[model samples]
Target: MAADHVDHHEHHPHGLAHQFEDMAQQKESVLLGMWSFLITEVLFFSGYFLTYLVYRTQYPVAFAEGSHELDITMGAFNTVVLILSSLTMAMAVHKSHEGSKNGTLGYLIATFILGGVFLCVKYVEYSAKFEHGLVPGLAWHPHGEHSPQLALFFSLYFGMTGMHALHMIIGAGLLIWLLVKTAKGTYTAEYNAPIEVFGLYWHFVDIVWIFLFPLLYLLGRH
Candidate 1:
């Protein structure tokens, strides 16, 4: 009986490590780590954006023409969807902080569904592009005004959106794991660092799309 009690106490201690003096310190540590990682990610995406600016400047007409080929309606719709997902994700974190397990799970499911929807829309766009032979290096044959630079434009388009989509897939996977843990009550009002960290990541992904939508879809809309 003493051994079982000792194990229970060990498993259900306060939400701070021995090295950390309090919950605040532990939470601060987690937040700092996440922010630092996000900063690096920002720099990485900035490199891509810098490359985009240089190329767009080089092929202004071609880039403008290529941007018009993208489905503005679909891109706009995706922006709305991602914004909603970010809201649900924030709600998930808040609910976890409030000790509402069911609320957290529900919000997380909503976020996961929205993420999947974004990927599906991206698939539709990509499939149409592929059917039209717009993808570069794979039987690409442009028959439009931007024929010469269309390949370069498409290359960048694929590179940027593909990287973003990969992040969404990973985020969805993380939500699945969070869902399981929430179902099992691994996180509560006292300890919701995992979901909070994931929220940071999700918000980062959404912010990236916010930039992508305007640059890729709205360049020639006006």
Candidate 2:
């Protein structure tokens, strides 16, 4: 009977560590985990970048022309949207830490909308490429007597950007999960580790775009 009573007491709400203590441990673990995951992400994307480098070195002119085919305006717009979403995600974390549940939800919703807008822009860009027959490994060719290296460029472009888009989809799913948790009052002024971790992920995605924009759109432009 005493052993059962002890187990019941241990399961009591306050039996858990205090919120701040929990937050500290949670933050440390999450930061470590996020950095570890980011290292893997860098390694994963590096293969695509290396392939692009090899092909571009082999056929500079074709790569240049292929790069020109990309819509800089659309790419720039998506960059802006991603940056804004990062900002909103940061704000969501901040609000969570401040115990402002409604504010957190609002920022999260804003981030989601921005993410949707980014996807819409991406869709338009991809459709244009499709119409131009720029798909990788399928119906891809340079327009109007361009270098065959353009095919290689398109291949890398599709592979890398497609992977990035997949990451964005994952990020969106994570944000939705965070939203659900937020609605459940899982985060509070004293306990918001999940928000911080999600912020790290969102920012990492934004950082990838920072590199991607320069590599895919701006390179060989001037």
Candidate 3:
């Protein structure tokens, strides 16, 4: 009787939720939910991307001039940093599958740090734009021949990159929560769905930046 009771509590506490019949069912439900949320995010970003395409096509010269103002070196560095963070995030998921608490903590820490670094670099870039009076509305100063179109390029720049940065900030917050739970041994080989699901989110953020880098920074460098 004691053995049966212990098994019941064990599986209920960590392995399965009340709505789920078993561990696999719980994981599948959670993953499906995460994917559903991500699909909406894709739709959200797609609108911005489509708008950018339309405007860039209409104002090619102005957009190219705006792209020239961006620092490709810094943009490339952040791209590499996000790529490395994605690798670390994948490793963290792997460690969770192995039920290695310390391994998961270490990799999560690395990912958090990389995210911070990316945000810091973006801040520097934003500050430079502000100093140069490139920001739209507040202080409009355009060095390009097409002032109106040049402002449009910067408007799109901040709108897209700012949203991406906000996502990174939110991801960083999630990582901190994961780190705390991981340290407490909340996840194990049999029940690591949270970590795995978060991996999908982190990967999506990285992929968005991959697209942003080329579209905003390398659009007309050639």
RMSD of each: 5.6, 4.6, 4.4
* TM-scores of all predicted structures: 0.91, 0.88, 0.94
Cα lDDT of candidate 1 equals: 0.90
Best by TM-score: 3
What ranking emerges by TM-score with the best candidate at the front? 3, 1, 2
lDDT string, candidate 2, 1-222, tens digits: 445432223332321344424445656877798889989988988998888888878888888888799999999999999999999999998999799999999999999889888888888999998988888667766466654667778888888888888888998998899899889887878778778888888898889889989888998998
How do the residues 179-205 of candidate 1 rate in per-residue lDDT, one tens digit apiece?
999999989799899899999999999
How do all the candidates rank in terms of lDDT, highest first? 3, 1, 2
How many angstroms is residue 179 displaced in model 2 relative to the true structure, after the best TM-score fit? 0.9
Regarding lDDT, does 2 or 3 come out ahead? 3
Off by over 4 Å in 1: 1-15
Off by over 4 Å in 2: 1-22, 142-146
C-alpha lDDT values of all predictions: 0.90, 0.84, 0.94
* Model 3 lDDT, residue 52, Cα: 99
Model 3: lDDT of residue 153: 92
- Name the 10 consecutive residues with the lowest summed lDDT in model 2: 6-15
